[model samples]
Target: MKILIIEDEKDMLQNMQDTLVKQGYIVESASDLDSAISKVGVYDYDCILLDINLPDGSGMDILNFLKKNDKTEGVIIVSARNSLDDRIRGLNTGADDYIAKPFHMAELNARVKALLRRKNFEGSDLLKIGNLCIDSEKHTSTTQHGEMELNRKEFDILTYLATNQDRLVSKSALAEHVWGDHIDQADNFEFIYSQIKNLRKKLKEVKADIEIKAVYGIGYKLTLS
Candidate 1:
């Protein structure tokens, strides 16, 4: 999953970024409201960790912008403002959850995982498709035959396909979601093709009942074989 951390505190922002990265999430961060708005406008995220107080403006403005534009990223207000009014305002503004400062990284990780489950997997940790079972919490994929050995990008691609099973997933969307902001640095989508190729071989090795089907000119889709 991808996460955006909008925080002004240098130490706190770095800490949050490092923690999420260790948890296998693609993370990007902004220190002020302007960059935060710019990033939010241009990219998509699975979750956002927002600070109510920014150097340039209130994080509330960012939330308002998200709502006005109908962005569906899950947001958690990670701010020092812990007053009831602050919490109410944030929740009313569309934050999915809130965490006060002086918090543990483990707790923050848990909140992110919970919000992702609620948003993507219908609050379930297991995503089952055909004979394949994916434990999103554990970051593992297995079939009735056995576990599939996959690299990080391969697993990410497979998980994404599982989430959108039976639906077309545009290659650009897959690259953006898996590679995060770094997708802009790529010259072409040969990298994506490479990952999907290896993932397909692994799936076949495990004799998974699922398959990743290419859509000729547009994208790919996952379906039962």
Candidate 2:
């Protein structure tokens, strides 16, 4: 999944980004409110790790703006404030969860997973389609015939396909979801084609009966036939 970390503390922001990256998430960060707001407006993220105290504005202000813009992205408040009112205010302001400062990174990771599950997978870890099985927590995909390990991007593509099974997902959508802010650096979308090719090949080798069909100029679709 893609995540945005809005934190002013350089060390904290880097640590959180690195941890989430190792956990197989695409992460982008901003240290101030304006940059944070710009990211929230332009991109789609599965979740946002928002700090209440930013360099220029309150984290709650960013939250309010996101809410006002009708963005449904999951948000978790990571703040130093441990007051009851602060926690209550964050939740009331549309944060999915709140983690106070001096928190365990492991626990924060757990909350992120839980929030993603609630938002995307109906609070489940396993994503299944036909004979294929995906363990979101472990970031693994398997078939009844055998097990197949996937690279990070391949796993992300498959997971996305499983989530939107039977729907046509455009190339731009896939690119945005997988690479997030780095898509602009690419000269072309040939990389997307390559990832899909690899994912399809692996599934086929395992005798999995899933199909990823090209929608010609648009994109692709995962069909169970």
Clashes of each: 0, 0
Q: Give the clashing pairs for model 2.
A: none
lDDT score at residue 72, model 1, on the 0-100 scale: 93
Clashes of 1: 0
TM-score of each: 0.95, 0.93
Q: Best TM-score goes to which candidate?
A: 1
TM-score of 2: 0.93
Please give the range of 10 consecutive residues that has the lowest summed lDDT in model 1.
181-190
lDDT of 2: 0.89
Tens-digit lDDT track for model 1 on 55-153?
Answer: 889999989999999999999999999999999999999999999998999999999999999988889998889899988887889988899887788
Error of 1 at 47 (Å): 0.5
In model 2, where do residues sit more than 4 Å from their true spots? Answer: none
Q: Which ranges in model 1 have alpha carbons more than 4 Å from their true place?
A: none
Q: Residues 58-177, candidate 2: write the lDDT tens digits.
A: 999988998899998999999999899999999999999999998888988999999999887889998788898888888888887888878888989988877889999988878989
